[model samples]
Structures are given as structure tokens and as C-alpha cells.
Target: MKQNRLIQNIILLIGCLLLNSCYQNEEYMQTVQQNHLLIDIKDSGIYSNEPISRANTVGYTTTFSEGDKIGLYAVKNGEILPDVNNVCLSYTEGKWVANSSISYSEDKVGAIYYAYYPYDQALSTFNKTSTDPFEALVSSWEIGNDLTGDIYTGKDLMTGFANAKLEGRNYTLDLTLGHRMSLAVIKLPTTTYNFTNAGMSSYNVSPQNISFTIGKDSESEAPILPYYDITSDTYRILIHPNTAYTLKGKFTNGANANKSYTINIGTDIDKAQYAQYIVDQPEIINYTLNIGDYYCADGSLVSKDGPAPSNCIGVVYQVGTTDAIKNDYPSCNHGLVYALKRVEGDPIKWSTSKPSSTNWYEKYGMLLYNATGVDIQGYEETKTWMDIETGEVEGVDINSIMKSTLNDYRQNFILPSTTTDWYLPSYKELDALNNNATILNTQFSKVNGEALWTSATKDISYWSTTIRRQDAVVQYHPDNKTKAGYIRDSSGYYRYSFGF
Candidate 1:
């Protein structure tokens, strides 16, 4: 029995060896398929059919690398396989391709591969109708919208798509990438100034340090952008493709480093369509901001012609008045009186309208120096004396005080008589001026040939006759609602005043 068992074991061992040999031979006979994927990138501006290289990467310095996310899908046996979504493409030497799990298979000669760069969604599982196959997952920082926030910077949304069927073990796919953002390569004109001029000169501008911003009007927040200064007069900035943007450009001048050189670049550009627009009419979008476009605060320009600079206070509103100036205005039929242009600087700190600081006394008529010690910190209801008809302090004749101060200031300046009686507008009145700023600016532009307000000229201290205590009312332009406008100390000489 032992001999018979040994014989059977030897036969079993031989049979196992033969079967393993046959299996090995079968595997060796099967062919290994090798395939390749090719890529091409194109710009919307230059749609040259060229493959993207390191030199042509629009917003980035380097191309896809190891662990770079990409979307891929395969079709085998005429049926789409499981999508290899967001798989990192491996970088070998210079080329990038998906790993074996996504592209390699012995019988995958007929397979088709689809790939996209900067992958965010699973291209393989993309819904044909509802999903956008070419969209990238861009962040806000990447968009880098111009100051107005409506225009997108073109540098961030780089998208590409490629598809090719594998054949004969190896195949090359040709993909193309195109820009979705509009292109604005502006060439700023050389600013030539009359040397005889005494104001700002374009020669002082630092070309490389210039800033360009674009967006909608409501987008006041400016985004920092990388700009290329191709030449002293040329600049390039990337912007979003499909939206309109309001543009603002600024640079520092060596002559007036304390001041900013500013220009409004107009707001009709639709960045998405910029490329085509340029293609159609190259001169249409190729703008050149002239040196003369810069805003100046010179008072002489006030009566010249054009819109007022934002720094200047515009009209408050139109009110019926018999002031002689209204008779010459375009709206003479309405007896309209324009508010005084807002000025900068601190004016008089002392006012006769205020009561004496040391006495803290309430009087019907008392002259006082720039008084202090009025505390209205928590007095919400006592904000204005408009409603108080009884108190001598709150109900003091505001018109009389206005008439005297306006005449005094005019005489001091030795200027011509103003159109209307000038007086410190009440708090509510000033607030109204701020709220109706748009209308005020428009009407002033129409009536006055040139209107510009001097901003923060001398930190002018203005006196408000409306007093709460020993403290007379005072206002500083660009001052906020809660503080900075109220004056308590009045020991110094008055330097500035306000009127409406």
C-alpha cells in the first residue's frame, strides 16, 4: 500500500507541473497593447493649431506634473467603461499621462481616451446634456476680477479637451486649449505735457508701477493683478471673458508722489467677447489713455469744462430760493439754488453761535469762542434742532448766523458775491447731500460749466450754529456719521467753513 501511494504522488506532481507550463505559454502568447495620448492648446486670440508648451502656458509657468489632477474616460468594446475621475496624471520625463489603471490593458486597442486639464469634475461620468464638460473649478482668487468685480481676469480659467481612439497598440491624441477671457493689450500713449504748465506732468509717472482695474460700477473693491509692461507705453492685464467692466487706472508720479494719477477707462467692454471684438476692429478695443485724461484738482479747472472730480463736493439738491444767482441758472424758472461745492480743510473752530465753555450757561444770544464740553453721546432724539421750536439754544435763528458768516468769508477772500446765502447745512441737510450725491453731481454739471470740489484742502474746521451745549456743531468733509464732525474745543482760530 505504501508503494502504491508514492506512485500516485509522483504522478500528481508531474501533472501539476505540466499544467503550470501550459498556462505560462498561453500568457506569453497574448499581446501587450501600448497606447499614447496627445495634447494641443490654443489661445482665443491666436488660434494657431499648436501643441501647448511651457512657453505658451498663459497664466502659469509650468504644465501638468505628477499628482496634477485630470479628468479621464475610456471606451472599450464600443461601450463606455467606468470613468477614472480626478485621477492624478503622472509626469515621466516631460510628458504627462494617466496611470496604467486608466490607460493600459492587453485588449484595449479599440479603447478611446478623453482627458481635460486642471480637472475638477469626473469627465468619464459627465452627464451629456446637463453638465459642462469644459468648465474648470476656478476660485475667487483665480478670477481676480477688476475693481468693479464684474470682469474676470483671463489668466485663471485655462481649459482644454482631447479625445482619441487607441489603434495598433499606440495612438496620439491632438487636443486644443483656448482662452475664455477677453484680451486687452493696451498701449498707453506717451504723455506729452506743455513744460510751461505748472501742474502735474506725465513725465513723473512710473510706467512699470501703473495699476489697471476693471469691473462693474458697484464693484468698488480692487483686486491686485499681475501686469506686464511690454514697453514704457504698453501694458497688458488679463480680464474675465463674458462680462462688462468699469476701468480705473492709477500710477504714482515722481513729481507728485503724494498725489495719485488717475483716469477713468470707460465701462463698455465685454471681456468674453474682447478677443473677437479686437479681431473685428483692432482699433476699437486697443485703447490709449492720454496723459491729459488724468484728473486734476486745480481750482482753475472748476470753471473750464467737464465733470467734477469725486474729491469735490457736488450740489446737495435744487431748492426754491430768490438768490440772484438762480436768475442766471438754466433752471431759472424753478428759482433753484445750488449748494456750495464741498471743500476740504478745517475752518473756524470758534463760533459766536456757541455758548461759553466755562459757564455752560444757556442764553438766547451769547457770543462765544470755540467752546468745548458739549456731550451728546447718548442723546439719540436730540440729533438736530429742526424739531425743537421752543428752546433758544436749539431754536436760535440759523439764517441770520449763515448770512453773517458767508459775507465775512467772502470779504476775507476778496471774492465776488456768491449766488445764494451760504450757511452751515444742518446734520440732516448734510446727510441729504451725501445721499443725493448722484443727482447733485449731475445737476451741477449741467448748470455749472466746470464743478470740482477741493478735498481735504486744509483740514478746514467748519462751524455749525446748531449747538447742543457749550459745544457748537462742526463738520469735516469725508467725516462719518458718529464722530469727527462734532467740535467741543474752540480755543483756536477758525480756518474753514461749509454752506448749503
Candidate 2:
């Protein structure tokens, strides 16, 4: 009986071992049938002026550059898996490898994952408990939000993601990595300019190492720093994407070291287009910052409005397009006689508010009205201010009258040339100067002759100029409220003024 029992016990033990072995084999087969994930990461590589192409995929030997950290995450249906382990992939020996706590998988399928270069410290604690992949990313990784921790290094951030879904075979996930930041590339080609030293113009060394900011103001939220790029041979800086920004900078010259410059970026920027889905892609947005052709004295960049004129202050005063002035003039002109600077001393009286007579009003008044009899007003003053017709003056010339009535201090001053002849402006021209007061103030400021004088004297009242009535009208300020409407032709109280 003892021998039979021993034999039966041995058989039972063998049966248990075989059953365990079969169960293990079945579990292994089930694991093999589970779905795998393959993330084919890509970049659009859209650079300025470059043609668009296919998306670039990160290859086996591809990895983030030094100082670049990438953050990634996996998702399935909606929730983030805490047990999935790694959320960050580091660049090591030109290969993107899983973090210390996670194992790299070459298999095509797995759980959802999230990864970013220059990993986000703000979401370091994110794991299985986190739900909603899109919501999590939007909340934690906002473009301008703060990413705290030693891992972030406060550098520009890049991001990518992969969704979690079971696949019987390799499931290809075309993941795109985009920059949450932007860059501005500026190029200052070698240029030769004559510098004026001690009232003389001569060649001088061009300035180098300009400091700049890429926003509306110095306190802007999205500021830019200019750096040099070797490959493209230009200056570059990172900026916020999809936002309007102005390029501003400062360069030093002699005593003008803090001169500032500003230029508009026109539109928001998209991503930089790199080569077609190739390997060894750098994480950056290449934006070619346009510096225009000319740099103004105010430290601003301006486009080349044709060859700059000589013997002028370089301020383009666009005038002459109203009433009797039918001649087509240049869109921009050099400061012919003077700019709106504060000139000191007494105000010179223009003329008396006489009746509609031939001496002054009839001769100059016709110049203020169209040939078909349209009284020029401030309706569209910018379009009409330049309409002074010297050819239409029947009697008293506008330029001669202005010179005779000007204060003795300005009697022998340089007169306006044929191309830039100065003359008393009508109601429309005066209004144009007032409308552009802000721009004028920014460009020029003089203490002595800051006041404006118009050649419009009306017979009855100040409103006469507006109604195109009997000619004698005058205004002390741009508002047209202050006036000496009843002054005499010999009235020294009013001063002579004209537009160039």
C-alpha cells in the first residue's frame, strides 16, 4: 500500500508541473498578440521663402542636440497611463533613448507616451492618474507658460506625442515635433556710408553689434534676442509664434549710442521647413528678419524709397495734391526748407481779413480752388495739401507774399528751390500739418518755431475757411479754435508760414 501511494503522489506531482508549463505557454502567446506602437516622428521644416515639402521623420541615429530637451507622452482613448513609466527621451550618442526608469522598445505597439526636448518640469509629476491627453498638454505646456525645474534650463521647448491603441501588428504613428518658440534671423550686409563729422560728410566705419528687441515695446511679454547664424550668415532670435511683433534695436555711433530702431514683422510666423523627412534635424525656427534698405537717424529701419536726396534733412514731407495743383509729385521728398521744430521769438502777422478783393485773395484764392470751382477743405486734407499751383497765380504770387511778410529774423534764410519751392498753404495744407502732428513731433522738435501758420484769411469769421467763403481766414493752432480773424493786412500780430 505504501509503495502504491508513493507512486500515485509522484504521478500527481508530474501532472501539476505539466499543467503549470501549459498555462505559461498560453500566457506568452497572448502577450505576443498584443498591439505595438511605432512613432514616425516628423518635422514640416518650413523656412522663409523655401518651398514646402513632405514631413521629415526622425531616424534611428537621430537625437536632440546638446542643450535641447524633448518631452513626450502616450495616450489611449483619453487617459494618461501612470504605469507606462518614461515620459522623457534624452539625446545620447545621436540616439533618442528612454529614461532611466523605462526600457526602450523596438516593438511597434505599446501604451500611450508623451515626449519633449528640453523636458517640461511643470509636468514632471504627470503619470497614470492624469486623464485627457489634449487637455493635459494644453494646460501644462502652454507656449508662453513657465516651465520650472533644473531639467528645463529655461531654454526654448519642443514637443511631440503618441496615442495609445491596441494593434495586432506595427501601428505607425506619424508624430510631428513643433517648437513652442520662434526665431528671428537678421542679416546686415557690408555697406559703405558717408558720415557727417563737424558739419562735413565723409566715409566712416559702419556700426557692428546692434542690440534689439522683438516686440511693440521694451516691456513686451515676447522679447527677442539677436544671435548670429553660421549656416545662413545672418542674425537670429527666438520669438513667440502666431503673434504680431515689432523688431526694435539699438546701435551706437559717436554720441548716439542708444538710438533705437523699429520695423513690423508683417504677419505671424509658422514652422521652419527643414529637408524632406531626413535625419539630423536641428530644433529651431529659421526666420529671416528683414532690415529694409535704409536705417533712419531715429534708429529705425526704412525701405529704400529711391535714391536718397542730397542737401536735405532726409525727412520726406509728402504734400501738394489739392484744388489747383494738378502736377504729379514724388511720393516722398527731402525736408526742403525746414521741419516743424520749436523756433523761438515773436509770431509774424500774415495779412488783414479784407473783403474778397484782387490784391491778395483773388490771385492766391484761385490757387486754393479747382478749375471747375471746388473749394479745397480738410475733408481729405492729406490728398489735397499738396495742390498749390504757382502757374495759376493771376496777380500776387504766394511765394513773394510769404517772403515779404516773414519776420526779419528769417528774411535772408535759404529760399526753397524750384523742385522744393515753399509757399503759403491754403486751408487744406494747414489741416494736413495738424493731422500729422504726432509723426512730425517724433522726427523733429524746435523750441522757437513750433507754431503753425496758414495762408488762409477769411473776410467774416473762422468758419469762413471751412465754407470756402470770402478768403481771409487764419488759425493760431491746429485745432482751428484760436484765431485773429479780424486782423488787418498790415497786422504784425500774425506771422507768415508756408509748406514745401
Candidate 3:
């Protein structure tokens, strides 16, 4: 009886062992079926400029049944290998569309899952295990609020979607998913201001425009707005939230006069007050004058005490009279005369001895008398004493000689004849010569008894070169004509040519 009992006990033990093996196998199969393999799908947009990584999760789920495990494994195409002892099932809402070129298949489940996947739980896991804090941030997401209908078991979500789910939890992804992102572009208010220096004006501003990014994420950084610098004379305004910004003011003064301007930003600026302020800080105006040292009308160098011509030296020649003795004193009887005269010294000198009665004037006494004689007839009688003696007797035309001598001096000595070979005096030159003669006569007693002719010829109305329109004393002068002055005469002179 004892032997039989031992044998039965051994057989029972063997049967128990086999039954336990069978149950364990069935339980393993059931576990595999219930728990689906959790894979985090990271949607990186269909058309992306940057590369995206696959989604990864940490801390596997412990509440999975044996059959659940089978379900998880069945979804995987290749052999389902769980890294952690505790398996979990999580979904991801990938950025994939219906017409996406992604190739995907499932080995176990028949349920057609759209591009949607659980992203919240996956993000949580990713955050827990990721070395970078920003790794869990969904770089690509869905657009609509409802992601369930668009998600698939093996596909990703559509591109440009802003919302998604992770591990069965809804999460709003703050990711730069699209190829292009739109920012709320706000134009900042511009303030204009003006500045002037040396009769020049310019306008400028401080800031140009303001720009910011608008979205549903807290991690998003504001866009970089342009800035203005006073030193660089460039301005940029970036309109932002919750901040009072000022635009640098600028202005342009057309006349280039020194003036101050205020820059007002909003509609609340006080124009009167600003104007007062500008007035108080008035800019100093600077003017330039074209003037030189004062001198006598005789062209002699002088100091401040020296008399200044009523008009500019340039215009004085236009209305002045000719003086006969201007070139050679005590001898020649031809020169420019001035209406306004100035003596060299304080005391005026007069002589009791007559010019011809003086002993020093004996040799030229007869010549002078003959030249001044009024009974001379024709050109022969007008000849000078020197000309008659030398057998080169020519008509001593005083007016002709004056014009020729003036032209010769101007063309040779007064001007740079080498560079400018043909800068002859114009008709205006004659007018200037006549005016110069008048000034000489009035200023000096040496310019007596001379006849100076002007280049102006008489037309049907009046002098050809006379100014007609303007009547002011400043305007009547011929020297003011915007051209070169010239002289003319009916007599011929010895002309010399320089060898080139």
C-alpha cells in the first residue's frame, strides 16, 4: 500500500507541473494580445526644411493585461520586443495626411487608425528621460481640435496641425512645424524731427516698426524687432505688448536755417508748448558774407579808415567817369574819374604855380599847349609833339588810344595770357572801363581833361548796354551785367604776336 501511494503522488506532481506550464503559456499569449506595443510617433510635417527625430517615451505602463500585451505586439510589423518589463500602450498624433507617401502596415489589429497618435503621455515620458528639456516640445502638430478622427494605428497626422495627443492625453504642441510661420506684424508710430547746420537741413526718426509672434504656446519667444540708433541716424520701432515706446523724431528744414522741432508720438502732444520749447531753444543762424579789405577808389591798398566805394568794386566800374591823368600823373591828360572822391591825407594841397609855368615842365610845355589847342583841324593837327618829330605822325585819337591800351593791358598783364589765349574783354568790359574812369575823376584831381568812350552803342531807344528792367541804384549799373566787359575804338594800334 505504501509503494502504490508513493507512485501516485509522483504522477500527480508531474501532472500538476504540466498543467502549470500550459496555463502559463496561455497567460503569456493573452498578455501579448491585450497590451499593444506603445510607439510614440513624432510628426515633423510632410514638407519640412529641417530634420526631425522619432518619438521616444520613458516609464512603461504597469496596468497591462496578458491579452493587452498580445494586442500591442500584434500592431508591430516585426518581432514585438518590449525593452522594459512593464509594457504600456500610448498613441501619437503625427503630422501625416491621407495622401502621404509613408508606407505602413500592422500585423495584428484590423482597426484603421488615422494619422493621429497620443502625444501628451509620450511628451511626459520624453520629458522625464530626455537630456534636453525642450526635446518633448512637439516640433510638428495638427491644426484642428479633434485629433481622434484623423489618427491612424500606423500613420502620422496631417502637416500644419497645431493640436495633438500623447499617451491618450490631449496636448497643445508649441512647435515650429510649417515651412513658414506668420507673425503678428505691428507698425510702430513714427516721430519726425528736423536738424539744420550751415544752411542745410535733415529729417530723422528713432524707431521704424514693431513685430511680435502670436500663438497658443507659452514657450514661444517674441520676434526680434528692428531698433534705431541716434548715432547711426537709423531708426527702427518694434511694436510690442504692455510697453510704452517712443519713436525718435526727425525733420528737414528746406531753407537749411537753424531751427528746432519737437517730435510728438501720439495725438496728445501740445503743439503750443512744443513750439514754445523750440523757440526757447532756438538754433543759432550763421550767414556767410563775401567781403574784403576796404580801399580807396583809386585801387590803392588801404586800412579800415580808408573810404569804401558806395557800390562793390565790380559795379563801381560800371557807372564811373574817366580821368585823363589816371595812368601818368603830371603828364598824361587821360584817366578814370570817380564821383565820390577821397584824398590821400587829411589836408588838401593847392599850388600857386601853374602846370606850364613851372621850370620842371619847360620841355613838354609847348607840346602840352599844342595838344590842348582847340583850333587844330583834321587828324594831322591832333598829332602829338613826339609823333610829329619822329616822322611817325599819326592822328592822336585820345579815345582810340585809351581803348587800345586798356584792351592790351587786360589781355596781357591782367590775365594769364599763356593759359587763356583768347579771353578778350567783352562789351561789358567797355562799360566797366567807363565807370572806372568816372570813379577816378571824382576820387583824384590827377584825372582831369580826358575823354573816355564806353563800349555801349546807341540803339533806337537808349544806350545798348544799359540795364532796363530794374531801376534801383544797385541795378542801373552795367558792370553788374553777367558778362565780360570790353572796349572799342576806330583807331588801329601796333599789334604783336608771340611765337608759339
Off by over 4 Å in 2: 1-42, 49-63, 66-68, 100-112, 124-154, 163-174, 192-207, 216-224, 252-260, 271-500
Candidate with top lDDT is 2
Q: Over the stretch 20-83, how does candidate 2's per-residue lDDT look in tens digits?
A: 9999987786555443333445543335423332333211112346444455665554555453
Between candidates 2 and 3, name the one with more favorable TM-score: 2
**Candidate 3 Cα outliers beyond 4 Å, as residue runs:** 1-37, 45-112, 116-500
lDDT of each: 0.38, 0.39, 0.25
lDDT for each residue of candidate 1 in 1-500, tens digit (9 for 90 to 100): 89999999999999999999999876654333343344333333322112333233223222444455445555555454654435445555656565644444455455555444455543343432323444433223255544222222224344444455455544555554445444454443222222232322222122224565565446774745535433333344555544445555655332222222233333333423322111111111121222112122211112113444442322323233222223333222111123334322334333234333443334333222233532211111122232323334454333233344445754554311222223344334334444555555454566442232235233333333334334544442335332233342442122222211
When summed lDDT is taken over every stretch of 10 residues in candidate 3, the lowest stretch is 270-279
What TM value does model 2 have? 0.35
| Per-residue error (Å), model 2, residue 364 | 90
Better of 1 and 3 by TM-score: 1
